[model samples]
Target: MKQSRLPHRFGKERGRNKMDKFMDNPWFVRIVAMALALLLFLSIQDLGNKSEGSRPNGMESNEVETITAVPLEKYYDSENLVVTGMPDTIEVTIEGQRRFVEATKRQRDFTVYVDLSDLSIGNHRVPILYKDFSEKLKVKVEPVYVEVSIQEKVTQEFPVEPEFNNNILAEGFEAEQPIVEPNRVRITGGKETLEKISYVKASIDAKGLIEETIKRDTKVTVLDRDLNKLDVFVDPEYVTVTVPVNNPRKTVPIKIKQVGSPPDGTVIKRMEGDIEEVMIFGWTDNLQSVNEIEVEVDVSEVTKDVELDVPIKRPEGINKITPERVKVKIVTDKAKNAETNLSEVPIESKGLADSLDVEFLSPVDGAVSIKVVGNKDELKKAQEGDFEVFMNMQGLRVGDHEVNLEVKGPKDIKWELSTEKAKVRLKEKGTV
Candidate 1:
């Protein structure tokens, strides 16, 4: 290239002098290089700022909506996993790339696991592992290791064979002892899970088992499957079973036990009930001790009624009563009265010494009412004097007599005696 202009004498001298200075002081040359590099960096930064401004603000991860995944159950160490410590729920946090995290509908899609098998017996720290991430997305779990303590495996023996613990079947119905193909099962787990175990229940629920031979593979399970297993290592796997049921039918008799008396002036004549016997159906063991039959009636609130209800009652300690109800009828009747009239009747007194004198002061005719309780036939013939009515007159001479009389009677009779004041002339009778 042809030189367009001649070098100035000062420029040439300065350039030459600068080259010499750089060669003499290397540190000065390094400082100048750094200054140039900083200038270039600033220019590039400015260009980037202009480009981003042309686009839009908040277009990065902040622009998109964020969603997180939460687990339903808590994660715990396996072998030593304390059932109590194990959480019923777990959660997965997804952020940064909102589209990728929100699009994952299930927790399984983003593999989440705590390696329990690798855990030691004692307390341990475990890390949560995650992978496959781009620059735009991120997982929040930094220190993924979680602290957990492992426990020893425990085993327990439970009766695997099914049994009807003293339960009786109704007549013509029997339980076919279940034959569990594998009688006993081995269950191994943590202590917490083992402690919650209930009875391992296996059942053969078929009707009409009396005198019948049946072969079936009954389904069996641990009562608390979450805690225990069906232990079936005992004899008689697939329970080879037999049932001996009898068609049991029996008749029973019932009686009554009277307690308190009826109200005063009232008597219970007839007490009736709904039934005398009740029918019962149950296992022989349950029905063996049954003796009495009872029924309930609305007699508890009975005060005044010609006909009162009598409820049947079952005696205590009886297993079952046949003819569960019965009707009891108690017949009752009202009392009757007997009357007598005596006109100048003789008043003969007993237990009187011969030294005393006696006379009749009142008119002999007197009326009295006598009440008696008995069958209708007996009361009709009952009489007043037939019982006894008397007054003592030995101490007085002939005189006007006014006195009330008392009457005595047999056990079944009641009596009342009354008369108007008597006016009899007085006279001196011979003294003793």
Candidate 2:
């Protein structure tokens, strides 16, 4: 048994020795290592070729980027034509290599504009254009085409009328005519649009206005006849509106006061104003205290007829006065007098109530005697026809009434009437 087990063990040992001999062969190990190295090299080469083939035509990987708020420029015959309906800005999306996209977004080295140079005076569809960008970039604008209206350019002058809300003025206060600086404006626009222009006005809000002049910068608007706003260009877009607001006004007579006596050789025959009265605006209290406006005239230096411009004295709290300065004529004649008496000067009645009539009862001829005194030359020029004596029968009842006779004559003469009171009877129309 021992000899047989020894052979089997020797056989197993022989088989193990054969496998060890095969594993220890250097040429086989060298072949296996070479195969593994060749497989790894092939794999690396394949990967490189695939990567190079993926990028065709020497192009690089691309990315998409969007740029916003890019201003749009226009090119056309702007001097002779006006263009409208063009957008101010647009957005552009670009697809290109990462480096170019980033550079384009950062540097903004591109231009977007519209070309209307070839368009005529009418509606036109113009294409948006772009240039001065990287050649590798593909750009797409948000709006590819723009609609524009081309019109013939024209210029016209329009008066600027000031407008305001009158209801906003303070109570008991009134506004004079508003004054606009640069009363007219030159407007340039389309010829068709200009034809429709009715008015150009400067609007001011009178809200919260009191007894003061309101001055403010107001925007100008162009409108049509129907008050519809029109699209136009104004050279002066704004104007200054000066609204003069004040209290109620009153017109009063200008009283001429003599400050000094006339020259020794000359006497002031008459002093009269060119304008009889002036309108003034002031507070209620101040107006109530004022009855008439007075201007003082100095006659000490006056020897002959003289014309002077006298400034009106304004009361405190008065806003304004019309005809601030009045022309006064001072008539002086030589100190020589002549008297003339005219008898039976015809008398008249005036300002009688429409429903009543008056009849003169005392003087049977309805006339009076008048005596005139003045310079010899002036007295020679005077006549009975120059005098008007009448009784104002205003507000009298239908009965006997005693009315004073009013007389008017030349400013340079002194006139005396025969009687101061007139006896008259008043009666209704139907009864009389």
Candidate 3:
């Protein structure tokens, strides 16, 4: 390389080096100078067309408007809203050119919703938010500072009643009075909404209620007087109605069943039992014809102590038992043979209610084989007049009945009678 004296440049080479440095700093030198020139020119010009003192871009001198917030009468509060009632739409006359008006009209109609929904229950003041507009623009409002009076919502409880349609109760069945478990419901809403509410109705789907006791869960529906459903709350979401229906009482004649057999050496002197009666209440078809009732006595392997336990029974058709267990005292003694006549004995009918008719069958006239165990002196002194057998037909209507004859004798004497089976026929007063 030729000797370079302190990096000296000349002619075309120097020009090329200078050009490269200028290109590197092109933005500052070119862009900045142009921007400054444009700014200076704009500053010198007036903001008006040459022909008139109006805006240069066909805009008015005053181009901005301020609109105030208008409150509303309601029980609710909201943050943002587009108000209604002034008109379906709002028209704005802008001072700007047609293009500006067209563009800003859409942008200018912005909403400043002062939510009354959340405000306190009393009157409140709220500010409206405006966007992209300067104080130069004038805002004309249909209604200003809308008198916003927020009323507090109220809650109330209403009773729900069942609505029955053409459904008829089943035959021999009647509609029971409808009783609601929780008759009332709580409704919470705005005061206006509460005022609009009319009544509450409980939905009763009788579609499945087939005439018997109808027990079901139903929903309580709040409705306006027009029967239109309303938005409300119920303290109890649902209510249950229990309807009790009554038909007729079914009577079943009770039958007596012997459970235990007497010991071999000792025989049953006289077996006696009263047929029990049971009245059942149920659906008509289920309780129609009750034939008899029977009771069961468990006397498994009972001997010597000789206490016989007997159970009275009603007809099998009757399912329920009025008297589950009745206490009966059975006496057992050594078998002895003695002849006794019914003539001298004071006939006794005990345990018979006043409404019964009694009759005597066997041992009424002739001598009966009286078997007993006691001191020889007591046996000798015992008279036929001291013993008696009577069958109760009192309160007994027309029917064929077999009653066990109860033998009444001196409590002090250890005597037993050997006749237990007695037959009696009873008829109604007028009937033969």
Candidate 4:
């Protein structure tokens, strides 16, 4: 039996029958099934990778983002109470759909703060809170909870001392006491913190080597006894400072001050120093008498030829020196050594009070004998005026006392006193 064809079914029946026949083929069926399965797997993979940021979703950091240095606002009784232990900034993490996350991070229209208006004076552990942001976004902040200290507000005045790095100044220069326009500053903070304030410094700043005077506007800082900075409100937070950096220099030579003796049968052939012109830094008047800078060395332990780095000692009146260390090459050789005895050298008394008169009791002539020992050639160059014998009578009163003998002489030769000390009697100038 044959079926009647439908209207407009001229090619419709043949197309449908051809499609049904094609589906019945095992090879064609397998190919179509494989294509559909592949399409489904691609769709699932695209969805799974959306959060990994592997592909751009037309937004920056589409899935999650971390915002740093977000200011942390504090809400408390600012007028009557002081709070501590809260950080000035926080780290906020925003996580949600790509659109919301990108919007929140870009706009940055959120607040992370702590509210302590309802609390009393004491320490309390409270959770940090946030507000004024998109509700669809999930927010997380580091240090979710904090321990805060609440105390009575107090205000006090602290003297502002100026501080600067004098070491950074130009060579052979000095910085005088810094002068602050207003020497004092007013600070407000917790009672405990105010009481712990130790230093209020107006730090002065300069660029590179400061040769001339420095004048600038700088901020004041409050610190505790341990030099730890304190968080507080300062009135007139800024101040003007003037630092007088002066270059009062004097050119001089270096003098070697030897302390010990050389070994027997060994003579110092020559001592050559690798130093040139030197500078002494100080006030104009203090630099007047500073003719040389002393560098001390010990020759007692020196047996063979060796090099020594001697530190240049700053004079009592000088403020600074150039070439802090001088490298010296010492040459030693075996030669004939001799000793020269200097007798009847008058001893001088220094640092004696003007109202007192000193008289040597044992050595009535106030004279001493010394033995200078060194190379025969070096000893021949020695002179009586080259050495100074003196006794420090700085703290002597109107009574008898024993004083130690000190010497100032050439450094290449070794010298010693016949007696270590001298007996002297001090009397009032007007007394018998």
How many steric overlaps are in each model, in order? Answer: 52, 0, 43, 0
Worst 10 residues of 1 by lDDT: 230-239
Q: TM-score rank, highest first? A: 4, 2, 1, 3
Segments of candidate 1 deviating more than 4 angstroms: 1-89, 104-108, 115-119, 141-145, 151-156, 160-185, 190-414, 418-432
Please report the TM-score between candidate 1 and the true structure.
0.37
Candidate 4 C-alpha lDDT tens digits along 79-109: 8999999988999998777788888888988
Better of 3 and 4 by TM-score: 4
**Per-residue lDDT for 348-407 in model 2, tens only?**
888888888777887757899998877777788988888998888767888987888899
Q: What are the Cα lDDT values of the candidates?
A: 0.50, 0.86, 0.53, 0.86
Q: Estimate the Cα RMSD of every predicted model relative to the unseen true structure.
A: 16.2, 17.0, 19.7, 18.0
Model with the higher lDDT, candidate 2 or 3: 2
Identify the runs in model 2 with alpha carbons over 4 angstroms from their true place. Answer: 1-65, 206-211, 225-229, 249-432
Off by over 4 Å in 4: 1-62, 248-286, 290-432
**lDDT score at residue 56, model 3, on the 0-100 scale:** 56
RMSD of 3: 19.7
Write the residue-wise lDDT of candidate 3 on 85-117 in tens digits.
222222233354444444556555444343454
Clashing pairs in 2: none
